[model samples]
Target: MLMRYVMSSLRISLLMMIVLGLGYNLLVTGFAQTVMPERANGSLILNDQAEVVGSRLIGQENRDQAFFQNRVSSIEYNGASGSPNYAPSNPDMLKRTSDAVKEWHTQNPDVQIGSLPLDLITNSGSGLDPHISPAAAEVQIPRISKLTGISPSKLKLLVNKHTEGRELGFLGEPAVNVLELNLELKSLMPE
Candidate 1:
């Protein structure tokens, strides 16, 4: 009689655990994440003979001299590389940012007037931020102009063109998506 009661209770508890576990995951992933709408429609990109190049929601990798660079990206555009976490005041973060500032300055000898953009040197907390502040984007104008043959004024216009103002006029900061700006540059640059 005692053994029978213990087995019955154990079976009941095991069944409840299985049901609740599946329910929790389904509610979070299936109902909440997948079913939700995203405001980011990826309105930026490039086309080489009509083939899509990159996503606006992802930061652009700095390589060629012609394009204005985006924020420092971790995982580097590889979806499989996974997201990077930012620990506030972490020593690693400090070291990385400090090193990047030096490297950027070393590479560009002409830029000498002001400090560098924080977003440009520091990785975004999510390691996935796709935009930079308008001011941050503006500082890169001179270098971009030198490479693309666009006037500084014209490059400023392009930066402004891609900048999105604060949400509802008060919620968020103005930002320029690098992917969109670069694609526009590709199309607008006089070949």
Candidate 2:
């Protein structure tokens, strides 16, 4: 007799839970998934037009000669490697930074960089940062000027144009997005 009462209550509770869950999904997430933006899927698509070769949201291991370089990445934008699992004393990062520093020195033999930018050496917290510090962007002006033949002053202007300040002007340092900047560069240059 007591077992029947418990079983009936249990059945009622289960029915209520199923009804509430279905109602919430249909009224909220189902509509959101249909009406809202889902650009990640589109961003992953490479149509050989807007996207040079691969997904623009992802980073390439090698820098293209014609394009401005952004931060270095260990993951190479592979979904498996995702965010770089960096140990503070990770030998691989140190070695990679060492080689990059050597190459940077080779490329800009005269410029006194003082110390390497952390962003230049480290993969961002999110692999798709899409922006770098203004200082980092500024430092590359000389090298970019050489590659693009756009005067450093002009490049500085472009960087300034693209640079975005922090929220309310006090949260974070200014950042410039490489992909966006590169697109602007393409427009400025004739095919």
Candidate 3:
């Protein structure tokens, strides 16, 4: 009787593992692939040559004066997606923020530090966040305009064009995808 009970328990465990572990994963993957193939495949952005340039989902370092910069990334935008987890009082965090502020002042002498967006000086919880608040993008417009010779008005229009409204109309604040914005900006550059 004990032998029979043990065998029954083993059989149930195997059945559950096959059904829940393997079957569930297959079902979800199939549904996602069929329903949203582009998203399932990483939402890759392509250039005119159809070459994969980057993903709409990941952030990258953009230091060129001609382009709007992204938020400070603790992980250097390697796509690892993490924060430094520093406390508000941590000296290291304070130093990093100070350094970022100094760099911003150096790079954007025209914009006052008081008006600078917090996102420009702080790292996002996910270091790979590709979007920045619309305000953040706007704050950099003057610098980008001066460097690229694009009119400030035209750059503002571009920022507005690239800005996305909150998810489902109310979930999050408006944000501009830096990668997409930069790509469009590149086209507007003098050739």
Candidate 4:
């Protein structure tokens, strides 16, 4: 009787493993691939030559004067890590924020700068945020306009064009995907 009970338990466990582990995963994968193949296979951005430049899910650092920058990344734009747990009173955090502010000032010397945008100076929680708040992009308009020779009005229009609304209406604030915005800026560059 005990032997029969053990065998039955083994059979049940094996069946559950096969169904839940293998079958469930395959079903989800198949559904995702059929429904949204591009997203399923990583939303890769391609250039005109069909070369994959980057993934839409990852943030990239754009230091070029002509390109709009993303938020300060604690992981240096790497997605492998989450936000740092540094307290506001921490010297390292204070120093980093101070340095970012100074760098922004240096970059926008000619513009009439006011209070710096928080998004520009602080790292996002994931440390891999590809999007920046609209206000953050707005503040950088002067620098990008000067560097690209694109008129401020046109640049503002481009920002608006690339800006994405909150998810499903009121979930999150509007944000501009920095990678997408930079790609658009590249297209607008004088050849």
Candidate 3 lands at a TM-score of 0.93
- Name the best candidate (by TM-score): 3
Candidate 2 local accuracy as lDDT?
0.70
* Clashing residue pairs in candidate 3 (N, C-alpha, C atoms within 3 angstroms): none
lDDT by residue (tens digit), candidate 1, 1-191: 99999999999888878778776766666654455534233444548776667676666576876887777766675553444465758788778877878877875657753567677787775666779989778888878888778899988998988999988999988999887788888887887
Candidate 3 vs candidate 4: the lDDT winner is 3
What is candidate 2's CA lDDT for residue 52? 44
Tens-digit lDDT track of model 3 for 1-191: 99999999999999999999999999999999999999999999999899998999999898788898999999998768799899989999999999999999999999999999999999889998899999999999888988889999999999999999989999989999999999999999989
Model 2 residue runs over 4 Å out of place are 1-62
lDDT of 2 at 63: 67
TM-score ranking, high to low: 3, 4, 1, 2
Candidate 1 regions exceeding 4 Å error are 1-50, 80-89
Order the candidates by lDDT, highest first.
Answer: 3, 4, 1, 2
Deviation in angstroms for 46 in model 4? Answer: 1.7
lDDT of 2 by residue, 1-191 (tens): 99999999999999888888777766776666667545424444333375544354555444665566777666665554456576768887678878878777776665565755668656777665566787777777777778778888888899899888897989988888677677787777646
Q: Evaluated with lDDT, which candidate comes out highest?
A: 3
Cα miss at 86, model 2 (Å)? 3.2
